[model samples]
Target: MAVHKLLDDLYEHSYSLIAIHSPLKDYRLAYFLNHQLSLKLKRTKDDFSYIENTSFSTFHYNDDTTDTAWHLITNISKNVVNETRDTDLFGIKSTTVLHYLVPEYKKVDYFLKIDNGDFFYQLNAVLKIINEMTHVVTAYTVDPNQLKSKNNLIFLSNA
Candidate 1:
C-alpha cells in the first residue's frame, strides 16, 4: 500500500503527527503522543517512553481549556509551528496546530491529516502539502461523509 512507500521514503528520517482532540479531553494529547510515537518510531508498546527515548516535549494551551489542544508531532521540534487563528473552531488562542515537511520528508509525495482541524482549514493544509508531492500520495482517516475530494485526499473510514 501507499503507507509502505510513505513509510519507506521516510524510513530513515523521523515523522510526527499533529493530533487535536475534537471533544476536548485531558488525555487526548497524551494518548495521541503515545500512539504517534509508537507508530512513527516503530516502537513497541513496551518501549514507548518519551523520557527515555525522545527529547520531544508536550505543550498544552494555557488558560484556554476550551480551545482544543493539538498534538504537535515532528522529528525536529523546530518543524512545529505555532500560530493564532481567527477561524470558528479555535480562535484567539495562544497555540495553533501545523507541521512543515522537513528536508527529509519533502521527497515523499504525500501528506496526512490523521485527525485534525475544522474541515476547511484541514483540507487546505492537506492540499498545500499534497501539491508539493510528485508521485507520492496522501491518506488520512476521517468520517466518510466529511471528506471532500477536491484533489483526491485519501480517505480512511474509522471502522
Candidate 2:
C-alpha cells in the first residue's frame, strides 16, 4: 500500500499590491486612474467591510481583454461615535475613530490590487503613470508576502 498526501495552496498569493499615497478622494482617484490607465473603474454596490461598524470604500474594474481584475481600496476607515464626557462645554461628545486595513502601511492612502495579472502585465508603466498624477504624492509596489495583515486583502472574492 502507498501513502497518499494532500497539498492545499488556497492561501497562495497570485496578485500584485501597489501602495498609493494621494490627497484625492476615492472617486477622484478612480477618475484619474480611469483616464490615465484606460480603465473604467466603478464603485461597487457594497464596500469592503471586515469588522463591525468599519468599512473601506472600494472601486473595481475588470479587463476582459487581459482577464485581469483591478481593485482600488481605501486604507483608512473612519467611524464616528457619540459618548458621554465630563468635559466643560457639553456632556455628550462625538469622536471619530480611524481603522486601517493594512496597519503596517498606515500612511498609504490607498491600495491598488491587480489580480490574475500575468507576466505580460506592465507594472512599471502603471506605477509611472500613477506617480505622475498631480494629486498623487507617490505610488510604489508592495510585496504581499511581507505584510502581516495580508489576509485582509482576500476581499477579492467579495468583488
User: Which candidate number would show the highest lDDT if scored against the true structure?
Assistant: 2
Error of 1 at 117 (Å): 7.5
Which residue pairs in candidate 1 have backbone atoms (N, alpha carbon, C) closer than 3 angstroms, thus clashing?
109-136
Q: Write the per-residue lDDT of candidate 2 for residues 84-148, one digit (tens) a residue.
A: 98874878988899999999999999999999749226899999999999999999999988888
lDDT of model 2 at position 24? 93
lDDT of each: 0.30, 0.91
User: Candidate 2: which pairs clash?
Assistant: none
Residue range 18-63, candidate 1, lDDT tens digits? 2222322223433543343332212122311233232323232211
Candidate 2 — what's its lDDT? Answer: 0.91
Worst 10 residues of 2 by lDDT: 5-14
Model 2 root-mean-square deviation: 2.8
The reply for model 2, stretches above 4 Å from the true place, is 1-9, 86-88, 119-121
TM-score of each: 0.21, 0.90
